[model samples]
Target: MPPSLPFLLDRTDLHLAELHAARLDGDLVGVGDRFSPADIAGTVDLRGARELRALSLLPRLPVGLVVERRTAAWLHGAWAAPPGPLELCVRSDHRVRVVPDVAWSVRQAVLRPDELILVRGVLSTTPLRTALDLLRLPPDDRYDGRHRSAVITLLLMQTSGRERAAAALHRSPHLPHKQRALDRLAALSLR
Candidate 1:
């Protein structure tokens, strides 16, 4: 049998009275879980953005939500900024309630089983998919050419270069955004 996953305590993990007592005593710091000091400072290298992203997300991500858009790119090494409000994708059937302070946004989409991957134990869009998603944004919504170029370079490196990116675009040619992805890829190649 596969080894069982380590228990990560969330609100539901504790009985109501215990949760309240832990919070009242300052033993539990965050809204989601009663995280110990060690869990707060994981083995992740403190200097890297990935570690920051993981730490910020591990406590806030809602059950069944998948990270996407610029957030996914940030997680995949395409951007250096700290993650802002959580951006997520969920199937049409899922219900997500508004979260205070966290400022989450969600997009409903038809997700193919293969479009998602895990990053630091969080489910996120693949690098290629994230690139494609970025390309689909209207010009004004997308980042500058220089940053986009960096994103393309990093994502391409993560996915073993151009072939896989090309294949992903080709596989979804019918998407209205395919040409946008092509344009972005072409622009990156010319740089």
Candidate 2:
């Protein structure tokens, strides 16, 4: 079995059939593809469970891809469920290629050095960067429906998440949707 952090079970810990059997046997309860011991399931923090669930995907994907956008927000304990087609980002100048036969969606983004953070050994965008990315997304885009809640969660999670994101938007060199991002941040701040 692969090394594990506290309160998480990965595929390497058991085969799918074995995991399901354990769940059916009332020994474990699953979140996405990972599981927590059944006895502690109700006591574990839901947000932390979600974070661990999202992190489980990391071992299944290639080594170099950085988690971003909705997925990162989920990792920050900002979403109720794991992201579908698991979103990831490759730096604009990075050579990482998307792996096939995996359930993930990849985008190329220009990330600043400060945008990344390592959580439980998983590399992902910081909540500020993740929220800013979602806020900067075109509001009219069809796929952005859940982005509002995710962005709100990301911003509210840290004491200065909103301020940091607002500052980043203000200092941006290219302003494709700077106003939109600021507006969204302001609206969330009022609530």
Candidate 3:
């Protein structure tokens, strides 16, 4: 028999056949491209947006990649299902060729030192930076309206999220969709 999988293990060494078998046995459920214990999802274990499993997500992400956008938001307890393709940002000077199953959303950005944080050895954008990125994100076919709305709502729920985003917005006058984001924040404030 194949070696038993760990409770929340979803690493490069995992085999497709093993994942399929675990799914067939009702012991695991698919999350993005990984398999997680089926019981933990809806049971008492699941507490709000920060699933216990999410703590491991950052470390499990491929090394040297800077996670950002919806993926970073999800990592920061947004809990809204992130894009199927892991949203990755590489340094403007670095070059990488990723071939994720659904294709990764990769970009080259020069993130400021204050905009990044290391979580469990994986690097990602700060929550505020992630919020800003999502707020200004151009619409994509990968995310539907509901998903975006849900992600936005969860973002606003973060500590001082609304205030911080507004302050940061005024600092950068050249950003696209500035007025639209202002209006959105105003409308969200009323609710």
lDDT to native, each model: 0.63, 0.75, 0.65
- Tens-place lDDT digits, model 2, residues 1-191: 98544566767877879888988999888765687778667675855665566556657566678888777877777766667878787888789866665688887888877889877667789888888878888756543547888887777777877777777887886867889888877877425
State the local distance difference test value for candidate 1: 0.63
Off by over 4 Å in 2: 1-7, 10-27, 40-51, 143-145, 189-191
How accurate locally is residue 94 in candidate 3, as Cα lDDT from 0 to 100?
69
- For each candidate, give its TM-score against the true structure: 0.64, 0.77, 0.67
Q: Per-residue lDDT for 34-128 in model 3, tens only?
A: 66677764463323224443444655465567888878777666645656577888877667665554546677886788888776466878777
Candidate 1: minimum summed lDDT over ten consecutive residues — where?
29-38
* Worst-scoring 10-residue span by lDDT in model 3: 44-53
- Tell me the deviation in Å of residue 1 in model 1: 36
* lDDT per residue (tens digit) for residues 55-90 in model 1: 547667877788888777667666664346667878
- Model 2 TM-score on a 0 to 1 scale: 0.77
Summing lDDT over every window of 10 consecutive residues in candidate 2, give the lowest-scoring window.
46-55
